[model samples]
Target chain A: MVADSLVAVTIRSLVLIIVLLTVFAYLMLFERKFLGWFHLRLGPNRTGPWGLAQPIADGVKMIFKEDIIPRDADRFIFKLAPVISLFVAFAAFAVIPVGPPLKIGNWTVPLSIADPNAGVLVLLAFTSLGVYGIALGGWASQSKYSLLGALRSTAQMISYELTMGMSLVGVILLAGSLRLSDIVTAQESLWFIVRQPVGFILFFISVVAEVNRVPFDLPEAETELVAGYHTEYSGMRFAMFAIAEYVNMITVSSLVTLLYLGGWRGPAFLPPVVWFLLKVSFFVFLFIWMRATLPRLRYDRLMAFGWKVMLPVAFLNLVATAAWVAFR
Target chain B: MATRSPEYFTHQGYEVLETLDGDRMILSVGPHHPSTHGVLRLILELEGETVVRCTPEIGFLHTGIEKTAENLTWQQAITVIDRMDYLSPLSNNLGYVLAVEKLLGLEVPPRAVTVRLLLAELMRIASHLVWLGTTGLDLGVQSMIMYAFDLREGILDMFEEVSGARMNPSYFRVGGLAADLTPEFERMLRDWLQRFPKRYEELRALMEENPIFLDRVRGVGAISQEDAIAWGLTGPNLRATGVSYDVRKAFPYMGYETYDFEVPVGTAGDTYDRYMVRVLEMWESYKLVQQALERLPDGPWQTDDRKIVRPPKHEVRESMEQLIHHFKIVSYGFDVPAGEVYVPIESPRGEFGVYLVSNGTNKPWRVRVRPPSFYNVMAIPKMLEGNLIADLVSVVATVDPVFGEVDR
Candidate 1:
């Protein structure tokens, strides 16, 4: 019985990591293709049939490329930074279930790595820890551009995390559970986005910043800091940081899916995972579209927007949500 | 006199023991920065992300073109000057040629002047397209760089057909144009003129009123009219400051006085206003190019003088005087009888002036360029002060200082 449970958990964990890594690579391809269409130019199509193998080709190139470290870099921290980044990014997905729980005769298991009771807290904690990698990478680089990028990223992370937390509190108040599965379960009658439009918007924008995407991408503002915190990272080390970013994007999109878009929930005929994928893909596409359209926010204005605008709106939303839930 | 804050505790007047205020850090922003336009370094005194002092450090791209100009013949010098403001090579060519024309007291035929005007305006649009695209990239509109490049490629195709080189056409000669326009040039121009109005609208819609773009640009990097004038800001940058100083209006050249086009001006000298002024100026240039193409006169493409303009091919075959004139002009080059001339022309950037001194020789004794980007870049420190480091990118983009010209 113990052996059966252990095998089930190992198999599930392996499947989740491999599937997520594959998705991360394909998401990049999708972004490039989408951005190319937006710019009215051809995106990469040379690697394989329809450039389906472009990600593999890129991965090979990243692996073969010589890893470089700045001569004056803090070697220990510099080496650890990307490990930390990729680690936390993948760790956040442990609790994110892609489908409803499955039953195999007498044994029943949830389709997740670990469905912790405090899943939302775990997601928040891990997502926030991802910034430490960037901060440490920037500090370890021993360069001014990296330093500035790290500083901007840390400040932006701290600011937006407040708004992100407050915005989620509205959902927590309504759903009455910290567990992500519970939140998704609570949305059986209706998606949370319908009841919490303002919260959805606040969550979307704050998470955009948290994920270091454009319009909120001041931390790695290529024009200003060269490549920001990862300016000094090279080869697979750099690839790790990129992979971490994509994984975070996936994680955030899924979180949004579960919390607001009724994850794995749909009309009959289509499977639960399919529905989950479609919703998450839509969000990922929205992120890519935004990168194609919007200009980055200036650092001070981004901070001002986060604190002055998003935070206050989030607080008001929380109060309104509490009152409505109390009456119900 | 002290740069550090007064509240900091100091030991022995030199060493700081403890600090009461926030620590200030000096950041060096690039000789190889993505958005400095070229090799320009900035030393910034920063209080966290806010810049307290910004000092521009140039001269990394210094190639001594002015010194090299003294050795080259009057005609050969135009090719060298092509690289000064290489994005608008025709404007540099126009300025240098007009200066020599002033010294030689030569009359450029009406046809040549009209063609020059058409090409120069096209160059303005092309340069502005580049500015718009790169500025969008600087502010993190990821797709705009590709779009801008795509549009500019159309204009470059026209340039290549006329001069066989897209960037440094060097198509304008000392007395007139290097070559006559081919039938293909007209078709290219017609195609561009037809296609670009829609493209112009598309580019404008991409960011003009976009709230995020506006938030990044509007009311950022503002310069007062008085300060702008003091810094000698010119072209769209000068116009953005509400000064309304356009060289085309102040010192008319190439029959610009007759062209029916309004100089676009801005009320507030912010980055957004600067961007708007350039956009409006591109439209005005479009109108000018359209008018010039329609009213292009048919006559001699060069001045009818044997001294400055090259002799006709048939004449060189038949007449000894003509053969001698062609050979001398080809080898020793035509002399500009001793004189000093300064011709300030309206380049897309601003006032591009050529100061030339002649010693009655085939080569110029002195050739100095008054490139507008130089003065425009010098005003950056003022705009950058008290703004975040992120704002520096936009401010530099607004200044539009091409290092090739700034450090020329």
Candidate 2:
């Protein structure tokens, strides 16, 4: 019986990793294609029909490129940074269920790899760990731009992570559980977004900042720091950092899906997995849309916004949710 | 390279540094950076993210254009002069040719004067469009570049129709223009003139009220009017300080006195003010183009002097005297009376002046350029010190120094 469950878990884990990695590759193409349309230009249309194979072409090129270690760089840490990033990114997905459980003759198989009781805490912990990759990558590079980028990432992550945590407290209060599955189940009647609208907005903003995307993408601001923390990374090492970023983006999108958008729940016409994917894709599209339209915030201003505005607002939301939950 | 301490950087007379407050890191930004506006290098002393000292190191794009101009004849020299301030090549051509005409005491016909005025205004709009787009790019508004460049392309098409070259046309000649303005040029100009305002409004909507953009630029890299004047800033950089010292209005070249337009000025003298002045300047240039097009006159394309202006191809073919005159003008070129003249005109950047000394020969004895970007670039330290590294990018964009002109 242990052997049977072990086989099922292994298969589920393998499928999750493969599917996630594939989605990360395609997400890059989708971003570029969407940005191209926004800018009134043709995107990647040369490699395959309508640029379908562009990501594969990009991956092949990344694999073949030369990997350089800066002469003064901390070689061990520099080598280990991207691995940490990609590993943490993929590992965070272990608790996020894609669909409902399936019964096979005598046993039941949960769709997720692990359904931890403290799943929400695990998600927050993993997302916070993402900064280490960028910070270490910057520090280990021995480049000034990288050092500054690392410094910015450290400060920015600390400021926004507080708001992110506080924002999630409101949802946790409403759902009355730390398990993400329980939170999704609580939203089966009505999505958490409707109950905690302020929390939803705060979470969305903080997640955008957490992912190091535009308007908060100071660590790798090309206009200022060239390529920022990963300026010295090349070949597969560079590809690893990029993969980590996109995968984190997908993971957070799924979190938003599972926590607030009614994960794997939709009309009867479509299957649960398809519904989950569609909702996650919408959040992903919204992220890309923000990149297209908005300019980056200044470093000092971003910190101020995170502390003075986002933190206070998130705290207020948590208090409001707590009061309502206790009274009801 | 030698390792220098923070005190060493401080003791080197980086005038911008008020006091060395803490641990400093020296960072070299560009000669190859994405946003230094081409080959401009800045040695910055940083305290965390704040810039403590900024020393602009130029000459990286030095092509020795002024020296190169000496080897060519006065008529042949226009080609090299167009290379300086390459973004506004027509303005460079106009300045050089007008200086030579001043030396010869020649009078450009009404038609040539009108055409020169029209093209120069169009060039101003085109150059400012480039500044607008790249500055937007530097500030992280990614889509402004595409919209701005699309608008500039239409003006470049008009230039191509007139001079058969898009970038450095060298269309202005010693006594007049190189050729008559084609009907194709007029048609394209009319189409562009009608479409430019809507396109410009679209660009303005993206920037003018954006909170992120405003936060990045406002009160950042501000210089007072007295300081701007002391630093020898001109053009939009000076006007941003509320000086209202436009050379077109003050000196009045190419019959600019007849065109009624307001010189836009700003009060704050910060990066945002500089941006606003240039934005308004584009619309003013559009106004000038509309007025010039309405008053377009038809007559002789050049001054009727066979010694200076080359004869028409048909006349040169039909008559031996005209052919000899054309051959002599093309080969030996026209000689200016032994005199030196400096003609200052309002280029797209600032007051672009051409100083020419002719020793009664076909070639100029000396050709010196008073490039506006040279003066504008000197004020970098004044604006960059005490700002953050990101503000350095914004300040550099607002200054709008074309390194081709800065290091000419």
lDDT for each candidate structure? 0.90, 0.90
Q: lDDT per residue, candidate 1, A76-142, as tens digits?
A: 9999999999999999999998888877776676888888889999999999999999999999999
* Candidate 1: regions farther than 4 A off: A1-4, A103-109, B1-22
Candidate 1 residues B1-408, lDDT tens each?
Answer: 113443332322323223324577767678988998888888777788788877788899998999898999999998889999978999999999999999998889999999999999999999998899989999888788888888889999999999999999999997788888999999989998999999899889988868888888889899999999999999999899898888888889889999999998998999989999999999999999999999999888888788777899999999999999888888898888998999999999999999999999999999999999999999998898998888999999978888899988
Off by over 4 Å in 2: A1-4, A102-109, B1-22
Report the Cα lDDT for candidate 1. Answer: 0.90
In the order shown, the candidates' Cα RMSDs to the true structure are 3.8, 2.2
The residue pairs in collision within model 1 are none
* Chain A TM-score, prediction 1: 0.97
Residue B346 local lDDT, model 2: 93
Q: State the TM-score of the second chain for every model.
A: 0.94, 0.95
User: By summed lDDT, which 10 consecutive residues of candidate 1 chain B come out lowest?
Assistant: B8-17
